[model samples]
Each structure stands twice: as C-alpha cells, then as structure tokens.
Target: MARESDEVRSGTLPQATGGRRIAWAAVPEAVTAGIERLLGARVVGAVSQPGGFSEGLAARVRLASGGGAFVKAASTLTAPAVAAFHRREIAISRRLPRTVPAPRLLDAYDDGDWVALIFEEIPGRLPAQPWRRDELERVLTAVTDMVRALTPSPVDGALLGGPRLGGWAALANSAGIESGVVKKLEALSPWAARHLDELAALEESAAPALAGQTLLHGDLYPFNILLTAQDVFVVDWPHAWVGAGHCDVVTLLASVSLSGMDPQPIAESHPLTHDLDPAQIDAVLATHSGFLLRIAASAGAEADRHLVDMMVALGLASLRWLRDRL
Candidate 1:
C-alpha cells in the first residue's frame, strides 16, 4: 500500500550535468543476457533515469514477465570510481535492513570488467526545486527517521570514509584551483571574501567532524532522493559513509539554497541538531564549502559541467550559512 504522506508542491530540479549515459544497447550483450537469466525474464524495453552523476547506466527495465526492475551497471573502463561504487552498492544493498527506506536489491552481476545490480524500481518522483516547504519538511524528517534507525550502522562503520567524506584538511594544502574560479569564490559575498582563510582553517580543525556510527547517504541532494505517496526513498549508495548524525542534514539543507531558500533556519529547526554542538556544525559546513569551492575551481580536470555548476551554487550556499553563523 502506498503510504499517504503530506502533499507537496510539484516542480523540477536542475537537469543533471554529466557525460552521455551508456545505453542499454551499449552494455556488453553477455552482461545484459546474464541479468535477464537471473531475473527469469527477458528485458523488452528500457528507460534511463536522468538524475544521477556517475557514468554508469541506471534505468527501469520492462521484463518479459510484464513487470519492471531497476538496473544499474558500470565498468572500470568508463570511470574506475563509479565501478568501485557499483561493487560497493552490491555489498551494501544486500545488507540494508528494512528500516532504511531504500530500494531492495534483487540480483547482481559482475564479471571482473562490468558490474550490474538489479533493484526494486521505486515509482517515486524527485522533490520539486524552488522547493515546496512541505516537501522539504518531509525529507528533513525522513533524515531523522533514517538516522535513528541506523545509529549502529548494520554494516561496519570503520570501513566507510575519512578521505572521501571529510578530506578538508587535504584541501587546505592542495593547489589546483585556477585563477578565475578563485575570483568568483572571493566575490560570492562580502562576508565570504573577508573570512575565506578563517573558514578554511576551521574546516581543517574539524577534519574528523564526520565521525559517527550512522550510515549516511553522504550525498543527499534532490536528485538522490525520491518521494512516493507513502515514503521517501534515498538512492545512489556509492558515496555512502559512516558519519555524524547530522551529516546528511548539512548536505540536504545546503542543496536547497540553490533555489533561493534560506538554509540557516532549516538547519536549526531539525530534530537532529538538538544534541549537536554549534561550532562542530559550522566546522563541518565549512569543510563542505571548501570542498565545493575547490572542485568548482578545477579548470581542466574531467568533471560534469552541470555538477560543477551545482557545486558553485552549493558552495555559495554553504558559505552563506557560515557567514550568518560565524
């Protein structure tokens, strides 16, 4: 039964910016055939989902049995990190408990070169942009629910992240930022321009701010979440991390700012923030700001222009949050 949740305004999020998706026809025939055999049905039609950033293929497939399932696949040849995440998703999805509102894993295929995972396709819509207040509230509340249910992550927390989730300390000493990007970062706001160095140092000091036992979606932007009549579903687990209780909260609130929403109050009102310290929260936000700013400045590094554009928006948003509180 579809759970009837609060109703929210409908709108579209920014289109994903990345390389062309690898078509189903492009998948090695043996790989698709192997997946068909596992499902006990042949695939008749397929539609690629448009919201994710990885170079893998994520789509809903119509099976010969007249049903559907979600299939996600990647190869090291395309992007090694994506392939790694696909393998990690297989391991993580298999162990997820019922408490987490994520799609269920049905079958998996990996032959050293390519990895594919079949999931219970969720017929849910992406949350609207210029976000509706009610819709945003549900997602925030859902984060608390997900965190409460996953405090002692079902999987080992130690294997999650350090370099991946909170690698701000490394950024302070790094140097690939181009000149024009730095100028834009400096022009974001008067407060940001005046206090850039301070924010970076605080981010460095809070290097371990992401520490905790909760399994985090780590990247909790709009595209990674889905809203059904009954539940909120989070997808794309390759970036999942073991982090602070409110880590996902920080990411979620920062993202909506791109649509011109004020992030400060939204961050404060959440139940998850009740026990967290203010300084640590700012520290973590600063770290995210640094990461985004740095990524936006990468001139020639291979990146999705759309993702870079969103990063620029999010970096400014995170910085604004810092300016207001710091």
Candidate 2:
C-alpha cells in the first residue's frame, strides 16, 4: 500500500526517529504474565515497533494461541509520563465508536505503577515520506471520514483547548519574546522575529474560530498514521481533543510540508479546509506554529533528540506555511 516517490526511494529525506525503546523480553515478568492472563494465551514472540518518542514498550506479539496483538506498556519507575499517557489513552479508547478507524483496543491492564494496552494487530505500514500524491489523497479522504464520524465529540471530559491549540498571544508578549525560548525560535527563522506581534494578534481570533464539537486526533504526524490496502488508521490518542475538525488536517499538512512537499495546494483543496475562511485557517496555523516553536525552543538538553528535531522542523514548516498564507 506504500507508494514512495523517487526521493524517498533514494532515502534522501531524514529518517524518522523516536525515543530509546526497551525490548519486550526485558519487560517485567509480572507485567508480561498479567498481559498473558488477560489475553488467555502465552506470548510466544514479540517484535518492537520503534516509531514514536516514548521511552516505553510498543510491540507486535504472537500468542501461543496463534493470534497476534499490539502491546504498549510503560511503568512509573521508568517512564512515568508515558504511563500517564497510556492511562489517558485507555480511557479515551474505550469510548471510541466502532466506526472510527483506530485499531480496536482489545484490553488494558494496570497495576498502580505499570500500565499496558492491548490493541488488535493491524497489518499496515507508515505512509511514505515526502508523500506520493495518490497516497496523500487517500489519507486526506480518511481524515475527512474520521472527522465526520467523530462530530459532536463522543468522549466525555476531553479537553476543549490546550497548549497545542492556543498560546500565541502569551508567547508573543514582551517577556516571552525576550526569553531564551523565543530567542531560540528567532534564531531558527528571522521572519518569526519580524512578525511576532502580528502573529500574536492573528491568534487572538483563533479561539473562537477553533471552537467546535468534533474530536480531533490533535497529533497526526506521518508516523502516527498507518496505511493498509483498504484503510488509513490514526494511532496515538494522548493528545486527542474536542475542537474544529480542520485542526488535525492543518497539523497534518504542516507535516507534509516538513517532508518536503508544498502543502499550500493540498490545504487549499482538501475537503476539511476548502470552504473555511482564509483568516481562520491563518489563526489556527499561527496557534500551531507558535505551539511547535515554543516546544522546540524550550526543549532541554536531556530531551529526546529526535523529538526536538521534529518539533523544530515542523515548527519551521508551519511558520513557512503561515508566512505564505499571509
């Protein structure tokens, strides 16, 4: 189902990166035994999946029963933040309607410190980098479908707004711009320094523009998406929120730009955004761009190198797209 362009075939694009991962064999015996008890089968084989910035366990496992499942596990002792995310995902996954395209959450286990989620094994691969036109179309169609299905926000207590959705105004304030973070951002792109105030003003309208009832995936990086012959599946829901449906599409198109594709045309014609006001789109883009730049700017020396790199790349891409729109 993958369609790679000549550049991707030649490996010219930066390879995807993630956090250090622990082998499934190294997982605590108690946790593994608990997972087996939940599955009603002994795990016979496990292959780790290394495509996200979580220092936890993500794997495809074969059971002695001859079936397979995707397993994600983390512990407070090792990856407390990731364990918290797992807890939230478990809550959100249980409420997801069957019509949604995410992998079905088969079961979950928690032992006060360790958390694990078991999902139905999906036979799919990450979408090609520097996306092929046809494949991008399919993925866009899938986003539209998912948006339609998630309208009115089925999950209760989901966030209406968060750091990812807003903050440009605060970030543009005098103290903020003078801080090391904004300085770091300005170093990455001089354009950001020149138009900080204008971008902040544009973002003032973002809150009203983004208010909606659709549940957004919030993070739709290519690595979080999987493609099979028949379907596109969005994984990783820790950042999911209830907001404008077009939000996810905007975030995704920004990533497309990061992968070296011009996302303007795709954004112009994509169903989720085609009819929206250009200014509204600009507001959302500003909000997102500010968010990414802030993260990139504030990333600590001990932060995951890959995660920081992606944040900076995608931040620049979103800012570039916003600049073009203006």
Global local distance difference test of model 2 = 0.80
Please give, for residues 26-75, the per-residue lDDT of candidate 1 as tens digits: 89899999989988899999998867778868888999899999998888
RMSD of each: 7.1, 5.5
lDDT per residue for candidate 2 within 1-326, as digits (tens), equals 12222221111224465766787888899999999999999999999884677777899999999999999999978789889889988988888898999999999999998899999999999888778888888999999999999998898844322537555566677777677667776676667766677778877867877888888888888888889999999898877888888988988887776566888888888889989998778877888878877777777898988887777777777777777666
TM-score of each: 0.88, 0.91
* Candidate 2 regions with alpha-carbon error over 4 angstroms: 1-14, 158-163
Strongest candidate by TM-score: 2
- lDDT (0-100) at residue 145 of candidate 1? 93
